[model samples]
Target: MGNVLGLESFYRRQLRQLLGIRHPRRISNAALYKRCNARPLRYRITKARWVLFGQVPRGSDRNPAFMQMARYFDSSTEGGW
Candidate 1:
């Protein structure tokens, strides 16, 4: 959770800097995202995670690494990453 918040904070700061937005000017995150035509960092991260996970199932069953991933996925508890 701390890492997620840190990444989001860094992302917002970089975007604000890129657009020359400074302390004096107040901007909502939604507005900032609209201006940049970008999604939130969390959404992007979630999408990337799903994409990677999707690839795991497509991997060859004969590969030891893929088999390990399969076992991990099957054994992992709910609410895990």
Candidate 2:
């Protein structure tokens, strides 16, 4: 959670700098995103994470990493790592 917040803060600061928006000319985050026609950084990160997670199950079953992941998800494993 701390990492996510740090990333978001960095993203916002960069965007503000890119658009030449300085302290005197304050803008709400929503307005800044609207000006750039972009989604929040968190949304993009979450979407990417979901996409990668979806691909993991589609990986070859013979892969040892996939087998271990399958075991981790199995009911008999009781959610243990």
Candidate 3:
């Protein structure tokens, strides 16, 4: 399973739990790489090899490989960086 910046893995954990980032021991890997404030795909997620965690957002035209299929129904899906 791989999509890189295009998001997969359950919508990248639902866009990193809508930015609060919760998973992998309730949140770890250096606290989701410092709450992803620097973004560079969260320091490339420990050099990605079938990721242990995920997220990718930096400006959005809603096409990060189809943007989670346009958020199913778009009842206010979420935000970004």
Candidate 4:
């Protein structure tokens, strides 16, 4: 069991070293216990609106044609005539 544990730790350290990653700091059990006992925060998303915020629509003639088709289909389904 000891040999297996040692080999596992050794391999983990070797993999980290090869990947240039630092070992994380060890946290004490008491600190973990305190964190578990802390109160949780209440969060809510308020006053939110969606906005188009990506690359501009390509200037292809097909783009507007597809959009117009979609809008027409939606209006017909919604009884807008």
TM-score of 3: 0.17
What is candidate 4's lDDT per residue for 15-76, written digit by digit as tens? 44554556475434344334445221211111121122122233343676546545666754
lDDT of 2 by residue, 1-81 (tens): 789889888888889999999989999989988998877878988999899788878999997868878888788756485
* lDDT (Cα, tens digit) per residue for candidate 1, span 1-81: 688889988898899999999999989989988999987778888899999778877888987868877666775566534
Task: Choose the strongest candidate by TM-score.
Answer: 2
Better lDDT candidate (2, 3): 2
Off by over 4 Å in 3: 1-55, 69-81
RMSD of each: 4.8, 2.2, 16.1, 14.8
Off by over 4 Å in 2: 62-65, 76-81
Better of 1 and 3 by TM-score: 1
The weakest ten consecutive residues by lDDT in model 1 span 72-81
3 or 4: which has the higher TM-score? Answer: 4
Instruction: Give the poorly placed runs of model 4, Cα more than 4 Å off.
Output: 24-81
Residue-level lDDT of model 3, residues 52-71, one tens digit each, is 22333333547563465356
* Top lDDT hit: 2
